[model samples]
Target: MSTTQSDRLRELLEPLVAAKDLDLEEIEVSRAGRRRMLRIVVDSEEGVELDACAEVSRAISEKLDESDAMGDEEYVLEVSSPGADRPLTEHRHYVRAVGRLVKLTLTDDAELIARILVVDEAGLDLEVPGVKGRKPTARRVEFADIAKARIEVEFNRKDQNEEDVTDEKEEEA
Candidate 1:
């Protein structure tokens, strides 16, 4: 897609995303035969549910229908969540995944499973467990070296408690 189209799409979708309490992870426009495809990926703090996706899909469809953003051509509008395996694209994505385990492949073809300790202007600081007699090491990797990374979901009661506390704080604030 051209930069102009991408920018225009972002302008049109930002408000919709905020109104729906969703993060606009990506917007892709591609040609599929005679029709164009507009794919919108959204996510929420607790993960996006099917109903939420439907709602956003409906809203976006309406907006597109009303605005003629895709011109006179026919188009398909799809709204969905960026699944569990979605790459961490934005700094906010990394922030949201903090304290969660992630598998990242570095540029050197080395893979590491570590808890995201911190995210700063530089990049991600990860904590990887060490071998016997060796101290755990922390690596500060520039975002560029991170070829691929995804959160590792684990069923743990402690995580539930932490989420609850976070929810309470959000409510209070």
Candidate 2:
């Protein structure tokens, strides 16, 4: 996608997303055979629902129709959440991944799979799952040491209820 086009779209549509309480994760304009395809990925701290996507899509589609951002081309609009496997990049992304398992590749060519315990500005407090029945251990992985980080998908997680990745808005009384 063109850099200017992406910037323009973000500039015009970000407020529309913010109005509905979502973070605009990414915007891509691509060719779909004879037409244009515009993909908008959005997310919120609580995660996005189908209705949220539909609402954002409608708002954005209407704005695009009124504006010339797409340059008079017929385009398809798709809005959705970042999938389960999306890479963790920004500080907000790591913060959102707290209490969730992630696969991290370090700058030293080592890989660690751990659940995020806490995320600060500099690094993450991770609970490295133990092997051979050993108890889990805490490990600190600095953001600088991370080469790549992606959320690990777990199906049939036995301890699913134990890790609540939601924001802690209420403290224990």
Candidate 3:
């Protein structure tokens, strides 16, 4: 889709998303043969609920129906949550994934498995484990060369403490 159309779609969807108390992660419009597909990914601080997805889907469908954006083409509208394995695309996404393990593929044919240590204007600082004669290294990655990245979910949950919970609650408060 054209940039203008993409911007217009974002503008149109923002209010609907806000009304439903959800975050609009992305909107994709694609055509396959004679059919068009409109996919919307939405989320929230507490994660997305099925009712919220249904609500946003209904609102977006109504708006699209009224605007006739597809111009008589049959289109399928699908609304969903960015699943646990969702790709990290934005700066905020990277920031939120900090302290979690991630697999990143760089442009230089380097694949890294590391824990996200920090995110700053310069780039991401990842703690990569040692190999052979190399010590555990913290590498700074430019924001540009990250071809693909996603948070790695560990099967084992780390232990937490009362102090940790208290600190988190204080911060939220």
lDDT of 3 by residue, 1-173 (tens): 55665577888888889788887889888986789888889877677889888988999889888885657879888999997777888887888778788889888878888888999976799999788978888889988988888887777756357569888999999
lDDT of candidate model 1 versus the reference: 0.84
Q: 1-173, model 1: which lDDT tens digit per residue?
A: 55678688889878998899998888899998989998989988788999999998998888878886778988888888987666877888888888788889888889988888899977899888688978878978888898888887666637768899999999999
Q: Rate the local accuracy (lDDT) of all candidates.
A: 0.84, 0.92, 0.83
Ranking by TM-score: 2, 1, 3
- Judge candidate 2 against the unseen true structure and give its global Cα lDDT, from 0 to 1: 0.92
Deviation (Å) of 162 in candidate 3: 12
| Candidate 2 per-residue C-alpha lDDT over 106-148 given as tens digits, one digit per residue, 9 for 90 to 100 | 9999999999999998999999999999999999989999999
Q: What local lDDT does model 2 show for residue 11? A: 97
Screening candidate 1 with a backbone cut-off below 3 angstroms (N, C-alpha, C), the clashing residue pairs are none
**Candidate 2: TM-score?**
0.88
List residue ranges in candidate 2 displaced over 4 A. 1-3, 158-173
Deviation (Å) of 51 in candidate 1: 1.5
Between candidates 1 and 3, the lDDT winner: 1
* Alpha-carbon RMSD to native, per candidate: 5.9, 5.1, 5.5
Best by TM-score: 2
* Candidate 1: C-alpha RMSD after superposition: 5.9
Clashes of each: 0, 0, 0
